[model samples]
Target: MPSADCDTDHRFVKSKVRLSVKVAPKKRGSCTRKLQVDKLHELSEEFRRELEVRLDNNEIPDQDEDPENEWQHLKTILQETTGEVNGFSSRKNKDWFDENDAEVEDLLKTKRSCHAKLLTYPNVQAAKAAYRTACSTLQHKLREIKNNWWLALAERIQSYADMGNTRAFYEALQSVYGPVNQVQAPLRSSDGSGLLTDKYSTPFWVAGLSTMGTFLVTIGTYKSPPSKTYPNRK
Candidate 1:
């Protein structure tokens, strides 16, 4: 494990043993660096102070000498300062289906064993065959479990809605959708026209028409030639 404040680079390891059950370590390969960006507002002062100090200490390489090296130096400083101040973020893994946990754990162990055997005995046809079979079985089981989980979740959400449990419904909705990152649907008018437009992929946030109310209008009202007077002229 990395520092307590930072687990972005480390994969979670679940180590539990029970009789007639198998446990396999989770792979650390998928680990990614996800900075605690949400904490920037709270920790910006510390980060900026330290970063400024490093810059003032003549640590930055001269741009005239080497632009690439200067950029790398600045990038390293910013990354280090951010990590020290805000650390990293790690998402909690939720169990997709608790009822089939034991079976899933066993399959995980078998798959891991097959993979290890394939790696150790690359030239052995039996090892490759076993690995492929294990992969297929594990994938099929996981898909089934996830499908069942989705059905159960939908029913649970519906029940919440039916029971008039607004708080629970909101929480369930949030859990399902997570955070919304997409920009809000916008309203705008075409560049040449002032009429309000609601269309696909409008970039502007909001717009209004120059005219909104109904009004009577008459066009091409008869105006006789200047030499010939009109009968309706007063």
Candidate 2:
């Protein structure tokens, strides 16, 4: 009889060996059972090292094609399975995955199917480019909206200032003035004036000047009549 380990029970089945763990009998809870070598690839030293590296990085090693990449990734993970086996065994196998290998393979098969389905969509790189374009457009519109808000707020503050509302004047100053003001404000400081400086009350300023010009032209035309003295001499 082969010697038995104190922590385990072993038996032979169909020329294959099986091992069951013996837990501390004094424990109150249910004992846990585990298949020691749950995967097939773990049986091979070369594949098991690859699996460890992939798992540590959470990334597959680069492959030339998408399908190949998927396959390689799955192959690395498949190390934990026994080949050509449908049932699990508690015994550690140097060659095959425990009975749970089939389940793990099935899960991987489902994932591969899902990934293949995603491949039917437009080119992923192109999709990302389009997404970036849409994001940029949205950002531009948001900036315009913000600028318009600033213009309205500035107008409101000017109205309050006209009415001698001291609080509103200060609050208006604290609010944003937006892009146009950035260069204009500094230029105004240096020159003591700015381009279209009277734009703040533009409508009133323009209308008054236009009305004055029209009135002056009308008066000048009326005062300068046709040459009546030349007609009398003729």
Winner by TM-score: 1
- Give the alpha-carbon lDDT of every model: 0.72, 0.53
- Model 1: per-residue Cα lDDT at residue 43: 77
- Each candidate structure's TM-score, on Cα atoms with residue i matched to residue i, is 0.36, 0.22
The alpha-carbon deviation from the true structure for residue 225 of candidate 1, after best TM-score superposition, in angstroms, is 19
Candidate 2 least-lDDT 10 residues: 91-100
TM-score of 2: 0.22
Which regions in candidate 1 have their CA more than 4 angstroms from the true location?
Answer: 1-106, 180-234
Candidate 1 TM-score over all chains jointly: 0.36
Error of 1 at 145 (Å): 1.6
Q: Tell me the lDDT of model 1 at 134.
A: 87
Q: Write the per-residue lDDT of candidate 1 for residues 95-194, one digit (tens) a residue.
A: 4756688989998889878777766787999998998898899889999999988888789999999999998888777767775578864443556444
lDDT of 2 by residue, 96-115 (tens): 12333564455445444433
Clashes of each: 0, 11
How far in Å is the alpha carbon of 3 misplaced in model 2?
55
